[model samples]
Target: MPVAGALTPIDWVTRFDELSARRDRLGAVELDELGLAAWFLGRAAESERAWDDAHRAYLAASDPDAAIRCAFWLGYTLGERGEAVRARAWMSRLFELCGSEPDARAGAIAMLCRSVGAFATGRLDDAAEFAERAVALARASGDTDTEVLATMNRGRALVFGGRSEEGFAYMDRVMLAISSGTVSDRVAGPAYCAVVASCLDRWDVERARVWTRDLSAWCDAQRGLEPFRGECSVHRATVLRLGGEWGEAETTLVDVCSRERRPETLENALYWLGDLHRLAGRTADAEAAYRRAAELGREVQPGLALLRRDAGRLGAARTGVARALGATPLTGVRADLLAAQVELEVDHGDLGVARRAADELRALADTIDTVYLAAQADRAAALVAIATDAPEQALTLLRRSWGAWRRLDAPYEAAITRMHLGRACRTLGDEEAAQLEFDAARTVLTTLGAIPDLARLERLAAGPDRTPAAGGLTRREVEVLRLIASGRSNRDIAHELFLSEHTVARHVSNILAKLALPNRASATAFAFEHGLTQPA
Candidate 1:
């Protein structure tokens, strides 16, 4: 038996079982409780029905305020469930009930709904304005739920609009309210999840890690809280992965992937699972997971590209990452895509494109001001420096990046940085320093089973001359293959490589023949499949 207002959805659901037989006797208040309990328990259809019933009950009882509340939840939840038309109908009903100029509480909820709609459609300014108005109205009406939720919405809008520090301050206030029990369980649950999600979207891993733990605890304490549990697990798995707890992250993701019914939640879990598998060099498993996530409408970008790269499909990796970056508009998401672009371009020996990408990533990192994004930017810049004969610059950047990764407790990323540090040191003629970095990186990669990276490190140590060409292609043939994969014609290749068109055509023919590819397209595919973007 929980206290009156501290929600225990399981207890209410049990009570619902006994009273459902006599549901006709239940009034608006009782029906409202049942609706909330049903929603928290993941019974969406039942929850909607009960909320509808409660709305009608409130109407019959001549309580327009209460009815408006029910309609708001119905509209919001319906929108979330992808029933946009039905959601609009409910919102229409709410507005009709409001009758042009409603009282403070009802108007606050209406404003909150508007804010949600605006945020969903990428109207950040409108969303923030509506949320601010909602907060003001809710505070005036003494509606803590509306005020807290509106504050969260405003924070998200601010963050997405690239005002990261201000947005986080607002979100921090909301969390403080939740921690102090100034908000109800219903409001607190979503607020906790939303703020943590915003932190993740901005690459504020430390903040997200902290809030996710708190959210998990909140869900656990609620016993039968179901709607938020899946999202909580997804956030937790992300934190685990970032902290280098890959095994635990995999377990959590696999469990959520199997059990979560929500498409978005399940998609995230599967994507993260793919990322984990990719790091471990389980290419087949990673591909399957990424494919499933894509089927669920997830844009599996940087992870998929990195997977292709690890599998030695450098041409395909670069093309995929470039496409993803072009389509993505969100700054935080673009930071990730740009980082991948930098890595791919560097590997393809396109130093100019890589440098531009690194510059963009550094700009984004400065704007976001998060340690994670900062480290990513540093690592990207270091890669470009390493490729362009700037070992001193690369070493400086790598040191900062390695320290950041260490502070973040991300062992795999730190190890990768160490490998790059070794390259920079060796380039600077510090053989002793290079050896130490290589040894440390090798040990960590071996412990983590990072097979692809370990193999790359071994090849690096063995020197460029020792590396073998893919598909028996000669160095010049591989170079021609790379140009072909980039959509370059024989004329372009001839112009770029200072050869006759006939000579370029001959090289292309040799490339296709060596790789057993039927035509230029197949040749391109082979180039991608075997990572023959550049000669060894």
Candidate 2:
């Protein structure tokens, strides 16, 4: 009963059922319609079967071009479903069918499929080469849809191949095409998702924000567009979370998960929801979200490790992060894991482990040449310096990190580095500068509603200044006193502050004598009572 040219998925389903009841043989078009309906419904096996049948029907009709198109979609869907071997086999069949004398449009489609295969296998250079060829061939054949896809593919390949500027340039062009309505509706959704993903992967937050806004506007203007809406919503939520809008981010991701029909989209939304919950200190909720994400086949990493660290399971946290770092190759995600490793190792007082992680982060930053990674590396190094009692060196590193974060417009990260800088300044006996930094950081953290960071800052800022000078002791004696109160031995204190053990002993004696304390324990108690042992 459906019109020939206006069949919805429901109409197609109804038609297919009626045809089956009448024992009618379905042709290429019918099979293709069924496949599309099954795909839209997230029925992967059924969709694959329908598409395979459509491909054979097209071949039987001697429509090699239509069959090749079906092959491309089948291969693409298979790849997305993680059936890489079958995907490659379908792509290989397409290549064989096309042979050497294919038309320009067929050649372009074949190259596009090859590019996807190369990208899947991590041969970025080959992918770029194939995508470029596709673009040229499609343009010559006036195939705008293929050209658009090829352009996006080429951009991603170039980005992964370390030509990010050029890659983003191509991506920007594709975005222009999409905005101008030059791209086909079929290509627009995937193109937008690809560009946004590339921007996020490269730590190009500003670009991601711009593209996400554009995508939101585009989605708003369209009615009933489903394929990319969930992905766009996720990207929008990520931008919100990064901008310190945690409540809105939580709401957005929850909405996305509720409406997402695809397993991949639902999994991604749930993972981000877990991240938001964890950040807001909703431990049980975070665990539930993470569990659901895991059930959907998402690997909950660095976030899970951080949750363990927060729960006082330092050993488990250490093992989880170490395993994650070992398994992950060098990439943006690896940089994030390394950053967490540095923080965890520093807290565990494993300065050597922290230093190694920091070194690797610095190397990764240099390789990627991204400002965000550079800032993270500097912050990690600064934390290690602080843990090792090199406050002056820590101050320098923290300043660099603060500046980098500021340049990137990352307010939360900038504020964190400022707080560390304040501590470093306090350690160096510059109370005036320390107070200024603390006040500034407090304002930012409060505005962002970063509860844990604010709480830590409150703890650090609680104690009144009780320097050795005020207690009839020198600054060096005050430094030694605090370390002693922290349970460091004389040798440990000496090593930490880069002092000789004899000098440290002399400082200890001076502190004991001045305070009229009989022993180190009493001195430590005095330090605590006077608040000298509070974090600098």
Candidate 3:
């Protein structure tokens, strides 16, 4: 074939296929290359077959070291595909071969496998120990591939064990090695994915954004490569979304969702699609994306609940979010769910439940200590404080959250936090401060095209009591206008407001006159149009 790294994966695959068709039997090294080529082209079955054949050939030729490498790859690929039993069998075979050879490279691979197992089973201490042993063995053997993999594993374990700084340090070094070409091609793909995934899991958006760019470039260099391409697209889309490039983010997510074969990667793309659609106020599209992700066994939460709330289905939103928080354990975006729960409960006027969720979120933020989590925790606490009439406390938290969101370059979140700040300022009678905050938030939301948030801000700025009294109509007249929109007659309004029929009739006339409406029907339409009423 071509010399190593001279041809793209596509070119390598074409040459390998031509040779395989012409030859009676390909050599073990050829088969190994074919396996990697097939994997890069998303041909999982072909890759497995080639690797298995190569493993058998290596054994037949008494090359146990090469055979052990093949076995490690087979186990790794199978485990990634969720074929746990088959993966375990291969790993077991790898260990058995290592027992006979007793070499440092083989020992390193075996230790890495053990670390993976322990981590999967939640034995963080054991996982960390095994990963360190693997690292030591790989270093002794001068196996850069095993060293990178083992270091990434140790870092991941440390992150999971609540030592995020140490874990990321290890992961960062591994990434540097990968960037410097110390890592082999086979190890490079997995290494890039591992470090980026860890960065995203911790909500280190800045790190994720930078690494995702590197990953995209790396993927682009290897034409026909599919294993890590989906993840790269998903991560790039996230960075784009956070940076307010909604159109491009949507395009990337849609492309990945349509093409990605891996269920987990596709699920992530779909979930992000839902969130982007929801923020853009495309309710039906968001629901469809979320439903598809849920079908693929993704926990499409917080975003789905927020969608319900945006549609004015507050009860459904509260119920769904509460159920999600109750069912989900404290891991893997649980902090996001808790933050949503706190906000939903606050909006539903359940201050006690909101406070509990806020407390949990605060604790999670303290433990995670990431910018995103900290911002979410502060905002959730601010919402609870606002509901409980602790305006000063809410203001303090909102400023912190606002600064964090601004630092993260998340215009949408920053604007939303400013809206909270406005509310707190209004509650404390700082009218000028409140007005400035509201005006700033409105400008950002208007620019972002965040329809629901923009609408809410409009209502907040409508009147002193957050009542929408347009066209110079008094608050009492606005109330009458809303009732009229609900199809309430003058007599019904009179009874509800404990006023005389003449007084209620007078208020209705004044509302129509102030709004320059010809009749009650026009008045009703005007009320709904101006945020004084909503559809049932």
State how far residue 85 of model 1 sits from its true place (Å). Answer: 1.0
- Segments in model 3 whose C-alpha atoms lie over 4 Å from true places: 1-12, 15-19, 329-332, 464-536
Alpha-carbon lDDT, every model: 0.84, 0.80, 0.84
Query: Model 2, range 87-118, lDDT digits (tens) per residue?
Result: 88998888888989899888999999888878
lDDT of 3 by residue, 1-536 (tens): 22212223345457557656854578888888888888877888988999999999899999988899999999999999999999999999999999965889889999999999999899999999999999999999998888989999999999989988899889888878877766667787788888888887778887788788877877877767788888889988988998888989999999998888899999999999999889988889999999999999888888998998888899888888777777764454788888888888886658788889889888877886789889999999999887755678899999999999999999988999999899887656566798899999999888888988888888877654434346655455667778899999989988887667876776776666656789999998887778888522
lDDT of 1 at 271: 92
Encode model 1's per-residue lDDT on 226-325: one tens digit a residue.
Answer: 7888999999999998887889989989989878999999998999999999988899999999999999988788899989888788988988888888
Worst 10 residues of 2 by lDDT: 1-10
Candidate closer to the true structure by TM-score (higher is better), 2 or 3: 3
On a 0 to 1 TM-score scale, where does candidate 2 land against the true structure? Answer: 0.79
Which residue runs does candidate 1 get wrong by more than 4 Å? 1-15, 19-21, 465-536
Residue 374 CA displacement from its true place in model 2, Å? 2.2
Error of 2 at 387 (Å): 3.0
